[model samples]
Target: MDMIADFDLTAHNTFGLKSTADRAVLIDDAAMLPELAKASAETGRPLKILGGGSNVVLAERLDAIVAIMRIAGRSVNQQTTDATIVTAGAGENWHDFVVWTVDQGIAGLENLAGIPGTVGAAPIQNIGAYGAQLSDFFQSLTAYDLKTGTIETFDAEACRFAYRQSAFKSEPGRYVILTVTLALPRTWKAKRDYAGLDRLPEDATARAVLDHVVALRASKLPDWRVLGNAGSFFHNPVVSAEAARAFEDAPQYPQVDGTVKLSAGWLIEQSGLKGFRLGPAGTYDRHALVLVNHGGATARDIAALATHIRDKVRIRYGVDLVQEPIVL
Candidate 1:
């Protein structure tokens, strides 16, 4: 196990910040994981399981061994009743799979098209947008339990998914997802819950819905690969119906149950932080929620900017917008 030492992790993460990993190895297949487990135990080192590296910010240098999941495959099964059980290897590109599934006429994942990250990390965060979440399509996953060093199956019930939160995140580094099983119907009606999606012209096809979402996201989210961003820096706050009623005159989006969801981006914009800057890190002019690094910036620089926004929102509105990505 000749793991590369002090490897640059800037390119590996979406934020594109300069960072290093003391140990890094690409695990291309599950069959090779047992060997990795043995190697980790031999060295008594904790392993860092990195996937597409979109939803994480490495703030400091780390000495942990990095096991990059590289498993990739797709088995589109018409074997079931008008249902497509598309199982993807953990390392498979997420948006690419979404596009492929849509091409195959699968309907479940159409709303989630264009999200970054690998298949393995999907269920861990229960990634969702545009009236659809990964949990809505997720059936099961095969994970390697680091504690027992054995492969195990986790069903949807066991995932403990909440709004942008999951069991995998709650119990960090316990399960390394290897493959994910998704259930998509060959033909199904789309979910038009959000007013923005509802406002789409009538007779919107699956592709039309996807196109609208992609355009909406593109209009705001800067390309992280080129501009150094991690999509939305904060998760939208969900306040209780009564608490939200206190801000009846204030803007809010209708949410599930009795909850009202306020937009974090709107809050940030209203706080006069749009186009604001701190060192090399700053808020995007078009989208306040997105924090971008203008060419040169450090991890601390971005973190500081995020902290500033959080503080301003808390002070101005008494609402705390939590950071979305994992900050190391």
Candidate 2:
């Protein structure tokens, strides 16, 4: 473990918020975790894990010890008649991993291409895009229990995945993911139920789906490297059928459980907050769902802007908009 005191985290998070941690450790190996956890306990500072920093909002200064997960590896773990089990290190870039699967003729992850963050972070939020989610392909994962100081394996059922939620998210900082194992289907069929994907042909290949998803995301979301932003700022609010009927014009997707999923971006746009700016933080002009840092925006600025949007949307539509990014 490589340790740095007063570590700068401005570049660590995709939001590009200027932030620092009292101490940060580059965790390249899982074996380093127990020792690092011990030190953190001794110092009385909480150990916080960060991976790729894509889906997080960082405060100006954290009083905790940040563990930057960088453990890396990838392999085809097993081959079965129905599916191929692939394993990837927690620190592996998500998009790159998707590309690797396509290059290896593996399918099922193509619909999730272009999502930013590390593989380990995917299950935490059950990261999804287009017509598929991480839980759909997830077989199992290896994680280190911070509370128990033991390496543990969790299968799909154990993950308790819901839309943009998981057990890991419910109990944050209790486990540090080490590897994600996915079961990619051997006989793949195109998943084109989502809007942009629906335009794809019936016989689209995994590479084609990946390229299309990438293009679609590029056209919709601003590159985090170029413009500081977490991709989707809020989860699409799932409301009761009667509650959803109040917004007659808003796009709605009926859930299996009879709840209606409303577009958060539409709510923000209708609330007249899209392209609205407060100091350096604002909703992206192109996509209302995304909150962006114009330049030099602090975490406070982002939080204030988020609060403004939430309040406005709630007052206008009577639906609460929950933020997608984990605020630290």
Please name the candidate that would achieve the greatest lDDT relative to the true structure: 2
> How large an RMSD does model 2 have?
0.9
Model 2, runs deviating above 4 Å: none
CA shift at 145, candidate 1, in angstroms? 0.2
What is the C-alpha local distance difference test score of each model?
Answer: 0.84, 0.92
For model 2, how does the per-residue alpha-carbon lDDT over 1-328 read when each residue is reduced to its tens digit?
5679999999999989999999999888999998899989999999999998888999999989999988889999899999999999999999999999999998899999999889989999999989799999989999999989999999999999999999998898999999999999898899998998888999999999999999999999999899999988999999999888888998999999999999999999999988999999999998999999999999999999999999998787777889889987
Query: Local error of candidate 1 at 214, Å?
Result: 2.1
The worst-scoring run of ten residues by lDDT in candidate 2 lies at: 313-322
Which lDDT tens digits does candidate 1 get at residues 1-328?
A: 5589888888888888778887889888888777877777888777888898898887558667888878989988554776678899999999988888777777678789889999999987799988789888778899999888889999899998888988999889778899999888766886677656887766677788888888877876888877888888898899988888767666787776878888899889988999999998899888998888886677898889988999999998899889888865
Output the number of the TM-score-best candidate.
2
Measured on C-alpha atoms, candidate 1 has an lDDT of: 0.84
lDDT of 1 at 27: 85
